[model samples]
Target chain A: MDKSIPSLAQAVADIPDGASVMIGGFGGSGAPIELIHALIDAGPRNLTVINNNAGNGHVGLAALIAAGQVAKLICSFPRSADPRVFNAKYLAGEIDLELVPQGTLAERIRAGGAGTPAFYTPTSFGTDLARGKPVAEFEGRSYVQERWLKADFALIKAEAGDVMGNLTYRMAARNFNPIMAMAARTTIAQVSRIAPLGSLDPETVVTPGIFVNRVVLAENPAQEEVLNRQEAVYP
Target chain B: MTNPAMIDLEAVKLTNAQMAWRAAQDIEDGAYVNLGIGLPELVAKFQPDGREAIFHTENGVLGFGPAPAKGAEDWDLINAGKKAVTLKPGAAFFHHADSFAMVRGGHLNVAILGAYEVAENGDLANWSTGAGGVPAVGGAMDLVHGARRVAVITDHVTKSGAPKLLTRCTLPLTGVGCVTRIYSSLAVIDIAQGRFVLREKVAGLSVEQLQSLTGAKLHIEAPVTDLTAAQVA
Candidate 1:
């Protein structure tokens, strides 16, 4: 457990281009704005990123996607409304996209943390999502063995962190940070406040310090909400 | 004899179990609910079936629904124990890290549960007590603690003829003072002042008969009759 905290940009600038990254947030909430902004400033192009949903229009993960640094986006839903720009320019042929069912995406990341090579889940069994995936039957039911999903770096957002790196996520912003921390080789967190170790309730800490490699502090921005629209524009 | 106990039992169409589900219909829309396995799953079958309230699974679901089609049952799309499922519009998938967040964070409005034993003090021990061994305490720990309101549905008596709603739960605790309201075959009870506040009584059973079968005192609410089946929404 490192006791030092650095600026968000300094922590993320070391990550090279083409790295496997996982950002934590659901919809447009709880995104690590400081690290994302830092990554954009550093301009490490051609990277692969994973998250539950794409950032919503420059507020969440939307910042990185907007900066043209993301080479390929592997996600279930990209509701940020900027995928059109990504598709026309960066993803036209240069970048790639792998769209997956939400269940499969979570299981893959969970498998990474559980140390399971692969486990069969009935989630995408009969759908085209099972194409080329390992198949098996258990207890009179069939499932696909979705492979483990891990990354080189998992950038997470937390409401607060202690010197020991124990974390507490605030509300819906709590999305994928804890599991992503376990699945990544190096986990960095941006927290609004840094407290002494043992300050937070053990019952409330979502992601523990053991999985975290670095702690960065920045005044995280307020959460942005996605307004409901009649027609979704994504292809 | 004076009032002439309704000899006509013909209008009742619900099975013994469906009667229980009709009792569950009182759960308002937009409520956060947890449906236990078995007869309780049927509650979903009866809920005003549209996008009204959120259905949560201890295995990790916040916005997941649209029950599976008969043929396209994907075992993976299932709930906590891996049961097949369907997805509804406006449903979004999350890494359970966030789903449980909603639960533990007190974001849930209600949780409908199935129980084996509900104590007078609202203690519950529904997970285990099978013939083979102690039950596997899976996600029950999380769901019990996380859910804001826990309403249980179960039989009034155990298979061996002992009261299921006892003066105090005999099995290990799930959550301390966790339950809010209880719906059983013989009656519906709300925990009031560390005791069972009987809200409704079965048609055939009297207050004394219901009380003698229990380990706790019963507070009876007036006009106790069985619930009626609602048109499926």
Candidate 2:
């Protein structure tokens, strides 16, 4: 089935307020900036965003947060290169945060996509992050149990995509995009180029079409770090 | 009592670059290693000649090379520290799940990290100070326990001259009984049998002088070698 969409705004128009979204990126590498901006323009409220970092300067995710679209942030690092936006909101008690270790966060999203309910890991076993969680010992080693994290929607970026929604990402940009695509109810992808259906090599497709619901073209998308450097703020 | 004047000279303490260089010498060839953000990132610059270590950044890239020249950076290619990077010839990219799986699944050879404090019993505290601010714990907790061998590189004492190698960590921990070795500013020590085993100290520094700077008792096991590094131009 063809999953290609015409416009960024239309692709994100259906996302409602209070939705839990998993935005793909590790500090802007694979962040779906256009899709995020589209969602911001669509004007959703009370969103709980899942990302590696909360946001950098006043551009992408920070702009979304500044727009008052996010109510909570679920991430590993809230303090980014420039975390002024998140810091202000958090210190003022205007937003909530659920901090998870980076590996555990990735595993939780993987488990959610794979239909696993819960799993045990040795990470954060005796720290404040593991407090209030059930702990069990296996073979003389203790591990804390973490639950799966599924989202209402996932916004992701890709290097190349087909109308069938098969996606491939470039270099380090592949960080969370592929897994976030599977962990959400609906996955919206912004690709730099839309290749023909048969053009993508089957063996190299990082995310198959089955997990993707919508694909939009975002050729020459703005880089978050560059935008932050230019001190560009969104409306 | 520690003699401050006797230990304050550059000849007695290893510089940050020397400490990183000293730590990099121990990495075996063909090992998969993860270097933590700040001080640990310097380790990549001094990999021993004829030995190649594949660098793993938690962000997704494996086999990443040094930073690209000015204006040659691709924003999409960066390290776990979110700094611009370039890929080596044989580099591979995967999703975050697989990247962290390489970390949490014990597929990495060594993980070098910066420490705020390390207990004699091998406990590590580097993530937070429990201060009144936003607490951010990145992939540190996982790297400490997951890598096959965990080593820390840091100044032996705090900037205010307080001992960082302690009998017990006063701050929150990243992992319990996880660290195995430390390359500090003044010495190379190993954490074994719940004691600080002195392996090496900087040239011209006496055992008593080094001991005076440490929080815990330094047990003399083998003859301490001079902690030295090849001078980098």
**Residue range A31-101, candidate 2, lDDT tens digits:** 89999899889999999999999999888899999999999999998888789999999999999999999
True-vs-predicted CA distance for residue B41, candidate 2, Å: 0.8
TM-score of each: 0.53, 0.98
Worst 10 residues of 2 chain B by lDDT: B1-10
Best by TM-score: 2
Q: Please tell me which predicted candidate would have the highest DockQ against the true structure.
A: 2
lDDT of 2 by residue, B142-208 (tens): 9998999999999988877888999999999999999999999899999999999999998878888
Where does candidate 1 chain A have its weakest 10-residue lDDT segment?
A226-235
Where in model 2 is the C-alpha error above 4 Å?
B1-6, B9-11
Q: Candidate 2 docking: what grade?
A: high
In candidate 1, position A146 carries an lDDT of 71
Residue B50 in model 2: lDDT:
97
Rate residue B116 of model 1 by lDDT. Answer: 73
Model 1: residues >4 Å from true position, as ranges? A1-3, A80-83, A87-91, A226-235, B1-54, B57-233
- Lowest summed lDDT across 10 adjacent residues in model 2 chain A is found at A226-235
Q: Please state the Cα-based DockQ of model 2 relative to the true two-chain complex.
A: 0.88
